[model samples]
Target: MTVAADAPPLRRPTRLAYGFGSVADGIKSAAFSTYLLLYFNQVLGVKASVVSTAIALTLLVDAVVDPLIGRMSDLTRSKYGRRHPYIFAAAVPAAFFFGMTWFPPAGLSDFAMGVWIFGFAAFARASMSMYQVPANALGSELTQDYAERSRIYGLRYWFAYAGTFAFAAFALKFFFVATPEYPKGQLNPAGYVPFAITAASLIFISILVCGWGTRSRIPYIRQADEREASPGLLSHFKEMGVAFKNRGFLTVFGFAILKWTAIGLYGATSLYFGTYVYQLSSGQLALLTLDSFVAVCIALPLAPKVTKWFGKRNTSLWMALIGITLGTSPLWLTYFDLFFPPGHPLLLPTLLLIGAVYGTMVALSLMMTAAMLADVVEDDAVTSGKHNAGIYFAASSFATQCASGLGILAAGFVLETSQFPGGVDPALVTEAMTDSLIAHYVPMVMGLWAIGCLIIWFYPIDEAKHLANVERLRAREAEAKARDMQDAPLGAPAR
Candidate 1:
């Protein structure tokens, strides 16, 4: 559908405001992915299997709620606009529930704790989905230029990485620092409360600022076609069907599922790998948090240029390959003592360098994938005669949730089967347990990322195909406008 006006090219300020919103996402993701399982299983003495199952169930809930929110936003005709209303509304609840996930009541049984985890996790994830699905859809609505879209997403990824880096560093340095009672800061139960509060406050402020900053663009944003009847339930399902049929959407969707599953596994296991496998202290771990910040500084500027040179799909595939190699090689070397011994002074610095390289690849790959998805938005509009960015993004979100859920579930099974104990000291972790962690971690992460790279190779849309699609869509819209003018009543104003 045509917008109310020719949408202006996104200004640098607007791009920055939009990108800033991702800091909230980055904070929530860092907290949930990196620390949730560790906090519940190790700090609170809940079983790893129980925490994993609870999170997996919550993600399953998101699989339903995410798309519904997207479809609702797609059809919504509120005065404040389709996306911003939900984006603003989600801030408080998302933050509140997220905080609650970290602060369960004292003296609960394992079952009760699991129940509490499930309830809070579900609400927290759903609230974020309410915002994230629409915010992502809004990115496609912001601009139509292909190269410009890459730049926009590059900015978003940079902000996201920076935010994650800041949060991790802060937590490691201040909240989770080693104490007399708890040698590893992460094992301390007291630090999590302040961590939750800080993260929640940031989530609230970032979302509100983004919502307010972009409010002026409401006039230029696309609205539902007034001429068409309001969609019924069946029609909403039909819209989802149409979105899934687009080959470009499927390409991105499939790749994201595999890639995110790998990421989910990595996030779930990173604490264990760092603490037990590599024997890193909280202080040393904090130093490693700088990797993403360095990557963003290097990769954000390079993303658009690389996309211009190799095309989005090719760039994404190559970057994923490189990322998997860089991310996994250090671990393999450490395991086999191929390089410096694991406890050697130089090993941490060498690992940090590898992390930096991997992080840069990850940032570039994500930037390309987001840009590729924006291209698919235009392709969908051309083929379906509807701009269903929300629906498309929601489907992608669904895949992401599903992948993360399965990954958590698999992690739980591995932990239980390997007989990993809860509330244990890092020094007490057995060699067999480290081997189990490595076996589960390496294959899931490296293999799935490799598979994602392969899947992305078949993505049909290229720069040429996307530009052709945009032209065809412009012609179709022009023809529709002409027909509308011709059919207007004698005294009525033409739409």
Candidate 2:
């Protein structure tokens, strides 16, 4: 009878543990999201197509496996806690696999290299899932208060920024800039060392934090009895079909997919603008990252209040519209050549504008995404006979990964098509490069397909419906629990 409101707010230590898990996930995921394609293409000497195929194949297989993992994690049991044990167990292997992913051997065929890359990447991804699904499920069931979930998720995103800053500011430069032996002119796969070390070090520390830090908030749920569940693969498929056929759930999933894809494509292409077009050096990239880090702090505290004032739907819509404006301010600079000389002093103004606006949206949108997911889960439990927050989160996770994988593919292809050689002088800004970069940025910035994001974001799952749905869902689940109890002792005494 742990009603959502009746459950006390998470303790300080528990919140810290949850924050650690969020930070760890952010750190581990940051490398994959931001640097994987670049690492494989430039540092490890893999072709763009090869990197794309490897990532795409890994994700395709995982698309199915990840959902199953979420369901299994939901069904898991242990004294340590249902979710915590898998999280703790996955840490070491995740670290190992993340490192091995970047360790390319010499003189291997592209096919073998692709196989090796896919294997390690898949292992690392699956390992993260062990911790992430349960943690997300734990988030929903932690409290019933709508505003409180936003606060927890918002704080988690704050630390999530810490990871974002760490990976963004250092990981690439550390790979392409540091490593004493590789020096400045080296082109052999020797560049892999610094990248591997960086990935290994960050993910290892993240694993430790998430694994050890989260042990205390060990909320566990009992597995459903075997007799009451889908008894075969055919039944499982039927259940899955029913789950997807729920139009409301499908709407939420669509928004999540589009949102993450937009974010993912942006991540994969950032280096292009920095390195190829504006021709910023490692130092400049670090500064830009610092800009984003600071902006995240400014926007974090305000997100909850904004949601409260506007409600989740309008809050998200306004943020997106404003974000589209602010985020695309850089596109306005594409017109700078008309008003000022190519070497105009106002050049710095455009750069600063891009950095500032980029930072704002980066921070403001954190809780908007989290709140939408909360609504989606609430709707699911209300409409379906059972609650499956883990599966819904897994669906989001899969979409994000797929989007990221395709983006890696597209980014690699774009850079290769542009024929921008790597390890070239970082300061050589060129007109051709600027034109190409602007070509890509203008569409995304001008909110071309962003209209699609709007359509998906506005699906009918508003706050009132979510609240009503939760009440109904909770009643049904409680009744089902009562019936189970009555049936359990059919021929025996109650424990």
Candidate 3:
């Protein structure tokens, strides 16, 4: 049955209903977030240094455009509403070009290749921005109940990770492994297009799933506001500024930035470790599928309990610590390969546990942070006498882009220094390059996550404060509705 607006938020049908599309969303995001930079260097034959510069520059560009886009979305008007139209519009283009980005072409010098990458990548990211910003912002606006907000966000993110983790685990080998011509590597014709096509298909399909599943449930809340405000563009911009002024909102932004930077660094290294250092075949890389699955298994069920015990803020902090400690094992475990064959001595077991804890934390971050952003929006509504969900969520999304930008730039730079490909034959990675990669390049990433942990350690907001705010807002809303009832003109009744 259709439910009342104030009904308690958590329900299995909704959870199940959201899962398919959410997973698809995750796969699309995970592919771009995790793979594209390395693909540009190793497959498209763009030099690591040039690719690094191009990505870093693009990140800066997105950083510039992100919040503005969010503001624009808030002001957007169409028959379909503020968010969905853009999401639907972005899907096909995002799919086609994402594949195109991966396709390698012949006869281009590094200069022309760099220009091509710059133009296509900018468009690719812009297209994704068109969708992802609203998708995340919409999470908070889905319901007003605090717990329901948590449930919706938790389900959304759990599915997101499921898709991302599962995709990362196998998509690499699924497309490129069977084809041998890519062994030439570094922008070879065989390697680029095939990999691009595979990634594009996954991204396009995943977005469609999200577009389909969320259609019935999502409300066009922005369209429903009885009294709209401001000069459209300026209104969105001003609202974004207002949202950013909130201290609580800023804390969520820090976590998003630091946490994702940590994740990005890991994705960049995972390929190097799996392919170059561990000397795993593309087939072996498929084992990552298990790595992500185990993590999701642990997190999905345990999320509520973890948040209940530790509370969201402390829970996030504790999970980060756990990840920092457990995640380091993979690096040192490299030594164990000597005693046991190439397979992980404690690899599966270790990843399994880490994945569980990591997944829990990842989902928690997605849920709690999104919920918190919504609360911050509420704070404004209570203070300003208006409902402004879009602007608040947009700023939150803007902060996310900044975080992604830093992570991508960090990845491009670290890889640039390793003397890859042109310097060392793909036929055999130099012992020196391999050693340098493991000893220097790889270990440094753990430090990045560790630093991310440290930054998140100081994040604001607690369960007590959040609940108190919820109570205050609820009371205020009741009072506002009562006044409306008293002031009703004839048949107007209470809204």
Candidate 4:
């Protein structure tokens, strides 16, 4: 929550280390979101509904796993500290399962393939939660400065988006390539093995690098209170209830759900839109992925300044509005034939321009939200008498997973309803089917994002309020410390 005015400032290397760690997260997200459904339904010949259902069912496990990991990490005391231990332990297995998800086996039935996806996805999701929940909590622990938190998250997201861009480009350019039999590189089954290995390697290495890099901060990070009792199963639930009582946490949590649900829909369908509706090749897709890199390069420097100018809440609201406008407008225009026709030279550029704007907005909004959530930790501590950043972030993670599952489910439903059969060539996809897909996608994305923006508009934590909360918390801590000193034996050293 709050730190004393004399608290140590975060060093540049430490911040960069934390930021670079998210490359693992980026690779996982990009590989899963962009290629998972396509790999299963299109290449592996699993039904769309089956693949989405498997993903959704597995993610439900997060409702239990995420908070449990958060609470356990909060109470954990070890030489390596609460967060890093889990972070380090999770990396290898997470990488193994992530790789396995792509390489199920040859000649499996649809039901068997679905079962394989579920098993591997469940493990991958669990491993990711182990690292991600605590890693995010560590960010809140790393700094108490308001603007500095924004900068930290900016670096984090910059690395995340950059990694995603690299993975996307690499997958399109090298892993997946057009062949005489498989015109679209992504539909080629053989390439997935190398792609999986590459992504898994990145995930493993980045997690270790981030964990080791931030190891020095363990001494400074908040420790478990000796006075507090160990959390029981009921206690974990009670703690979650207390976290939900914080209005600021709820605002961010709800916003994340809606925002990420929209993201889920977009991610699930993006490859489909690009391949079928826009008829983009692997090279064109690679070019489009560059939008994230360009956006982050521009946004990373500007995010903190803009947050200072507009405040995190307002900045996020504006960015969301702008993003929603940019993201959906092109689709609508193209759908109505108001933009260039599908095969026109301008179509790809137009879509790329939209991607650039939307990407920038996403970078800005994510940075603001992460910082805003960190601010809530102190406010939560003031009531609960302990900093539980892990739990709060875990709750956010739960929302994200649920939103992602729901979004993917919706995408699958849309595909099935549109009669977009599995294993069909993109060239055989009917114009009517593409139109129906966009028809389902546009309203779902726009409506969810609009609702999320509306919810965020009511977030109560501004800079002034956050600073006041921090001051109050510091005063409380000082008073408690003084009380402890007075109660100690005369010869005992001060705490």
Candidate 5:
């Protein structure tokens, strides 16, 4: 009987370095979802529909650009390797464009403002894709071990949340500080430029540090030429079509679409909810950022174990179910007057506790989904004879972007329908407006997340199936090498 072996665990530094790259993405996502809509509509006086339209246009462009970036990364051949060159090239431009979004020229019409937003946001998304898709594909390649992938991804998510927590805590406390003139700091326009500068600087630093830290692994990773034949331009879409034929990737992609849409909706609304619904001050809201820290603590240690015990699919499904339930519970509980009311001393702490637990669930779900997606690289390779980790991850990334686009649109719809006033004092907002906003927001978010949970049930691979696929690929490799040896001329110096 033969005992099976798994890949050795990645070194802690290697894992941490790779994980650090996620900080850029984390900050960007936090900005887009949490602050972008709020700033444009509430501070800059752009219509909600206009802001959503601008962002939606950016996503439409991303829908095309993301996959092309992925395929190009897969086929790229160079001394620095497939992913790093893009990572290095994109860092500055991504930061520059992102920073520019917050500093639009004054006195532009709504149409002009929309154009400005679409242009800068498009460039920023594309530039980030240059780094993110390839970097995520790199994570997939860092190890093939079934369980260890979970750990690596767990660390990636941990760093992401850490970055998010750090930024939120600092921005709310320092940059968006309440003043006599602008008591609700989030609605203040003066703070946005400084916020953009700090965030842009961090984005630049994290991408470079990740690139440098992961440099040593380049030689060990499979080079582009070592991959199967590169597809022609016409065949690129064909390549993507074939990739989705794999059931595991398709199901995960489906789930990610819904999951991210829900996330985007929540992000877009959280500020409104906190400011008007809960009547929380910026200082009190800063305290809520602690939820992310607590989530990191809970998720980093818990993800691998739950994934191992429950399997990735089950872990993801349960986490999504629980997360959405708890995440949205405060709304329902408050509606029935069964929970803390606004200005209740216990309300903020109760929310913090709920957010911490909800954040943990979301972190676990995200980590498991990435690990599950990584596993499909081998399974798809076995069937298609092509190693296209970049395309697979890119498709997932596009789904996330596309869904978030829709989520943002939904947020705008909610605001428009609810008659939620923009560029006004939160104290001036009426209870009826907030109640109407919740009526629209909660149902839409819950529905998207629930559907996502249903789709994830269809993911077909588990540890046993993953290990089998690995062994089968290894066997084919051995047989191919044997045939090459047999076919070589006698004393040909091993060809």
Candidate 6:
């Protein structure tokens, strides 16, 4: 049975606090997707394959660890609660290791630099997983209302994008300013020092804020039974198997894998397109940060309303399709020379508008998926006699890491195949190189998006089914409570 639903609806301050925690995740994500490869490969002269390999390897290893952390969060009992302790403890090291990734010593060989990136990246991924897995699981615990979960996750994504914009804008505006000596500000080495420090500080602060802000939720959170047997390795796998057996979980899980891979691919390639294909300067690229800003503005209020109109599964599928179409349109248009040429006054503005819409659709899809994950918690609980939110979320996180890793690795392969010369000026890039990059990128990303869109059709839950599942769970809990009272000693309180 699920935990008591007596806790009051979350107030505005609490929701804001809860949403604010995702800022750390946002910063870390933006850093990895937007700047990490460029910094190492373009700035430091390490090969793109080497940097991508370092990132991909760490993510692959971390994917394996996510479930263990999720299972441990499920079992652990502490004064502060199962999720928060890990949440709090992860803050410092996560920031420290993330910061270290940007500060590799100068004059190192490419091999040595890759090793450095691999080592620091491993620690960074591990440390963040400590925070991310439990933090994600915590969202399912905070509320059980299906619609409310969507709203809560909408806010979560809102803050996530806000953090992304903040970090990206800051780096682009202040640190990565273009000069005569360095035409592409992103490739400037001196800027990385302050950028790392600022990012680390923000990561540390945001995580602690999330932990502190959500402490009130601990009392309302479901905890592991003190008397329940400790699960062994086989049991953990068995439990994970049970979670995946639910058709809803399986479908959403599959969709998340594909969706995130597309996202990772977009993140890995967007800068290259902006810098080379579009021939945008650093300041012009900085303006594109508004895309996320516009997305957050629209998504926060729009996602739940749209979900209410169309239902979660359908809304998610439609949004994914829309996002994929809009996001890829510019690339295809440019490829065919059907859109504004480089230096056209409308080029940047048109791209920005398209990005804004694309970002919103992606945000909506993610919110629906997260809400669906929470729904699966009860659906699994109905048959299995256990509520394993941790395992469900962990599996999703595992898919994310593995799929995103593959996407990043695939991006490396694309660059290698395109023979896009590293450590070269954007001005020196030729139309043939840009065309090869686009030709390789467009079809692969579209195929992944299409596959992901189709996977949503397999999800079994809708509003009615979800409500029915809630009723069944509540009825079961009532029976258990009555039986405990009947069996209790006369005049004693029942548990």
RMSD of each: 1.8, 4.0, 4.0, 2.0, 3.2, 1.7
TM-score of every candidate: 0.95, 0.84, 0.84, 0.96, 0.95, 0.96
In candidate 6, list every pair of residues with a backbone clash.
Answer: none
| lDDT comparing candidate 1 with the true structure | 0.83
Tens digit per residue, CA lDDT, model 5, 1-495: 011123345788888999999889888888887899999999988999999888878888888888988888887776777888988998999999999988898899989999998999899999999989999999987888888899999999888887777687789989898999889888778888799999999999989988999887776565565444465877778777777889999899999999998888888889899999898888888888757767887999998899778999999999989898998999877666677878998999899989998998988999999999999998998888767888998998899888877788888888999889888777788877878888888888999989999999999999999999888977876675577679878876331
Model 3 C-alpha lDDT versus the unseen true structure: 0.61
Writing each residue's lDDT as its tens digit, candidate 3 over 1-495 gives 011134344356645545554664466556555666666666555676666566556666566466766666565554565667766777888776666665546788877777766677767777777777766666655666656666666677767776777666555555545445555232244544565566677667766666665665444344434234235656555666776676666667667777677666666556666666655555555665456666666666666666677766666666666666566555555544432234556644555555556655555656666666776666666566545566666566555555565666666666656655633345577556655555654556666555655655665666666677667766776676677778889898444
What clash count goes with each model?
A: 0, 0, 6, 1, 0, 0
Q: Which stretches of candidate 6 lie over 4 Å from their true place?
A: 1-5, 488-495
State candidate 5's TM-score: 0.95
Mark the 10 consecutive residues where model 4 has the least summed lDDT: 1-10
- Whole-model Cα lDDT of every candidate shown, in order: 0.83, 0.63, 0.61, 0.85, 0.86, 0.84
Candidate 1: count of backbone clashes, pairs at least 3 residues apart or interchain: 0
Compose the digit string of candidate 2's lDDT tens values, residues 1-495: 212223444677666667656665666556675667666665665676777678767787668766765666555554554456667677778678878887767787868888888888888877776667667766676655677777777777777777777566664455456334433322235545775676567665665665566565554333444444444656545555555766655755665566655666666667656555545556566666666667667767777787678776666655666776666555445545543333456654566666666666656565666766766766766656455666777776776667667666655665666666554544564676666656655565345326645665656766677778768766766776566668875676432
Question: Which pairs clash inside model 5?
Answer: none
Q: Name the TM-score of candidate 2.
A: 0.84
The residue-by-residue lDDT of candidate 1 on 1-495, one tens digit each, is 545556676788788889999888888777877788888888888898888888888877887788888888887776777789999999999999988988887899989998998899899889988888999899988887888889999998888876778778779889997989998887888888899999999988888877888887787777775544377777777778787788888889989999887777777777777788778888888888866678887998998899889999988999899888888886676556576655798988888888888989888998999999989988878767778889988988788777777677766776787677778888788877877666666776788888888888989999988899889987877787788779988888654
- Cα displacement (angstroms), candidate 2, residue 268, comes to 1.8
Pairs of residues at least 3 apart in sequence or in different chains that clash in candidate 2: none
Better of 3 and 5 by lDDT: 5
- Worst 10-residue lDDT window for candidate 3 reads 1-10
